[model samples]
Target chain A: MDSLDIVFTGFLISALRSATPLLLTLLGECLGQRTGVINLGAEGQMLVGAMAGYGATAAFGNPWVGLLAGAGAGVALSAVHALLVVGAQANQFASGLAVWMLGFGLSAYFGAALVGQQVTAFDSIDVGAAAQWPVIGSVIAGMTPTVLLALLLVPVIGLWFYRTRTGLRWRAVGESPAAARAAGVSPATVQIQAVLVGGLLSGLGGAALSVDYTRTWAEGMSAGRGLVAVGLVIVARWNPWWTLPAALLFGGAEALSLRLQTADTPISAQLLHILPYLVSLVVLTLTCLRRSDSGTPAGLKAVMDR
Target chain B: MRDLMLSGPGRVVGTTLAVLMLTGAFFLAIGRDPVELMGLIVRSAAGDGYAITESLVRATPILLCALATALPARLGLITVGAEGQLYFGALLGTGFVLANLGATSAAPYMAMIVVAMLAGAAWALLPAVLRSHLGVNETISTLLVNYVAALLVTWVVYGPWKSAANLGWPATADFPEAFKPSTFFDSRVHSGLWIAIGLAVLLHWTFVRTRWGLTLDVLRSNPRAGIAAGLNWRRNVLLTMALGGMLAGLAGILETASIQGRLQANLSAGAGLSGFLVAWLARNHCLRIIPMSLLVGALLASGDGLQMFANVPSSIALVVQGLLFVAVLLVGGYANRLQVRRG
Candidate 1:
């Protein structure tokens, strides 16, 4: 293959891989925020999940077990968050920050031992008919199976969240606990479930980073992807479906930056490295400017302010 | 104050026990002895005067940052960019010295320190301005801006301020010896310790005695009530945030001048965000900050020892912190609900 082809293929694959971690995280965060709780601990949770998943996969030699362990870790942490913010009425911000600190420290401490370790990852399932097409073939050539699963999961969640009976109840609880409680819905249970599912998704997202992206465990590997995911969730305005494009945009910026660094261009490598963060800031600021009430989950503005 | 201390003793013991139990369980599951780890941590952190002094040195910037975070947190502002603010302070402070000092001199060093403080404060002003005016949430904005500041600092260091002689690292020339903080008792601890302690007391006085402080307390309790009571809520929030930023900026200055002595990429010892944690654990009480800072410092010191004694990976500290934070949040949530029920 020519250098151009290699660069293009590398960028495409990196973009897909980078976006997976953020995409999974944002989707989870979307659910958590939709239930009127901001899980700022997404960063911490993702880190812990990454470590847990990596450790489990390495120990058990089963990627699925590792994936489950990661999700379990995420859920466990989310349960703590749920107990604090929903059950005990702790300041969600403070609780979330605490989670971040704890997760960061723990991940770093445990990850040091797991560094230089490798895990077997799932193989990609390429669609042959799709591959026959020109532009579309390029997109799906090395697409991780989990990415497709995530895509399918989004519409299902979107339908479940907005169109189903339980979905309406969850939305109602998130919109106003008082109203929901009066209507015989238990906001606590709804929030607990939302948090649990969010944690599981976040764990899966973290696992994807190890299993699909790097295919190895590294200390502080989550970096700021968890935070970026949280930002994406905000940009998407708690909409599950929007997380895909939002994550892809941010992920593309990241991939482009990496490509620039490798191309040995005259541009400052540091500038390119920070490009995605700059994009996140710009996209976030612009999204904030839209003044669309439709994006915000009903009960979230008050919860966020508090 | 005495009543609160006495009343909270049981809760403190209970919380400590809970932490111990959880940590012990984790250790057992990992086939490590918790008691042995605890002993190793204690020995590394406080077994000798030198170790204790090092602990204090590490705690200095954190204490200052905690104070910075505490001020605005009282008014319900979350500043996660203390890390970034510190970097900006260090960069600007370094720039000030580079600009003013023709030679390595004490006067120039002092000026640079002052400049760093101001720069950090200025960096913080952007987030506060957006939050106060544009109604942007300070938490996410500050968090995002931290990455920006980190990048900006890296840019200046690697681009214009690159040390021509050094290879494979992004760092500026070391600060002149004269700019370094004076050591305490022939120990690694520096004058920054005094600065941190003094700020803690100063904040305590302000929170307790000053009308502005009382107004802030009121604002934190209920913003609408403060507005109804004719308190200038926006102005208070802005000023407090600015002050918080300035304090954080001061931490950045100290790190550059005294400890790292250069515009090191990620220059802070994670003191910026850790300070936020310290401040929160103190329940925004300035008086309690001193001990809280020390506790976190000790934990950090112990984490550093993991590599030496147990041959354990230092990442264990991060895990402990993650566990502690989640546990604390869970505990705090229950505590808050209990408080509500009592009320």
Candidate 2:
């Protein structure tokens, strides 16, 4: 490949890699929002998950085991959120913020040993000479398992939210829990299930960062991707299908900023680092301002109204 | 069943005790001596004048930040962007002083403080504008602005504002001696503490006395009725958020003017989050913010000592705060239900 082509291809691959965590997080957040339980603790969930994954991997020398442990850690934190918001009917934002702080503290406290230590991260898939084929090859060749899984989820979640009977009930719960209850579908169960699964996905996203992408643990490593996924959920208009493109857009922003650093842009490096967040703000603003198809979910409206 | 407990204060005390016991249990769970560290935590925060001074220095900004948070919350808004506002405040303060390097006087310092507050307010108002006009979620947008604020600080200090004396370090030039706030009691205690106290008292007064304050109270208790009564909510949202942002910015300016005396990478250092916690724990009441700020400040200061006393990460405090916040919310739920039942 020519040097320019090589750069573009490399950028595309890295962008996908960067977007992997966000994809997982965005989907998880969308599920929770769909259930009418807004989770702002994704950052904490990811942080703890990253630590659990890294620590487990280091202790057991098995990345899969570590990943499961990470997801378990996420479920654990999200359970606290469910107990508070669902069981106690506490303020959602405050509870979520508490979860975030707990995750921050838990990770920093527990992951102190894992800092500066490297885990056996995911290696790229070997497709041999088939990967050498031009444009499509760059996308397929040497991609990690997480990236492939995230790609699969785009279709799977879309199907799960659209094709399944359970998915319709999930939408019913999000739109109007009282109505869902009247229809004999338990809103509480749907909400609890959605938040739990969403937390697991968020935890997996954290593992993606530490074990699959960065191959190392750092305190606060989620770096607000959890929050970014939240904004993406709004931009996606609470649809699971929309998460795919929105996450990739954020991922593209991430890749462009990284490329900008090495490409000799006149903008200060610090300014460039903020590019993804700025993009999130712009996209969020535009999405909110645009008068669109369906109104916000009934459950969300009820909570926001209060 | 026969005896009823008094309400809010009783719950507060009970929650405090519960948190302490829970924290002690946590220390035990972690296989550390709870008593040793618990004693050390109190001692490190206030056993001596030096520790007290350091904590007061820390509490000054937190008090201001709590006011910043509490104000917006009173008007039914969640403004957690104090971290961003503080940075912008500090950045403007430093920039203003840098721009007038040749002229050194307290007059310029006053102007710089005013600009710092304004910058903080403007940064805060940016989010409010979206929330009020477009119905945007302030929680997430204000948070996004924090990263932007942090980056802007880095960009300024390392790029345009880099000083000759920095010696390859990423720092803005030192402020002129003229602008530095005077120290109190001939120690590290600065006059900024008084400014923080002054603002806290001023806010408490405004919440009780002013028409705007009365409007905020009405808005808080019954936003629908207030709106039904033809109160202008959009302007009020803007005012509360801007004022809150200004307080947070003033906190930043005080830190810049007193502590750091120049801009650096570690501008915020968890003050914004701590401020939010303070405001929450204080129930967003103006009168409660002062004591809550001191308590949270000491809690944070003690966290710093956790590493020294036990080889444990100081972040144990964050976990504790998390636990405490969850408990408070759960406890508050009962109070809300009680109020509704009485009504």
True contacts kept of each: 0.68, 0.71
lDDT of 2 by residue, B1-343 (tens): 1012237776687677767787888789889788887788788788788778878887888888989999999887877899999999998878888889876667898998899999999999989999989878899899889888988999998899998798999898887788889998777678888888888888889888999889998987898899999998889999999999898899898898788888898677778988898899888887788888898787777777667866768888777877787777766765565566667
TM-score for each of the candidates: 0.92, 0.96
Candidate 1 displacement at residue A268 in angstroms: 1.9
Q: Pick the candidate with the highest lDDT.
A: 2
Where in model 1 is the C-alpha error above 4 Å?
Answer: A1-14, A59-65, B1-6, B98-102, B155-160, B228-230
lDDT score for residue A198 of model 2? 83
Model 2, runs deviating above 4 Å: A1-5, A128-134, A293-295, B1-6, B338-343
The sequence of per-residue lDDT tens digits that candidate 2 reaches over residues A180-299 is: 999999998999899898889999889888888888888898888998898889899888888888998888998898888888989878888889999999999998788563747878
Instruction: Give each model's whole-structure lDDT.
Output: 0.79, 0.85
Per-model DockQ against the true two-chain complex: 0.60, 0.72
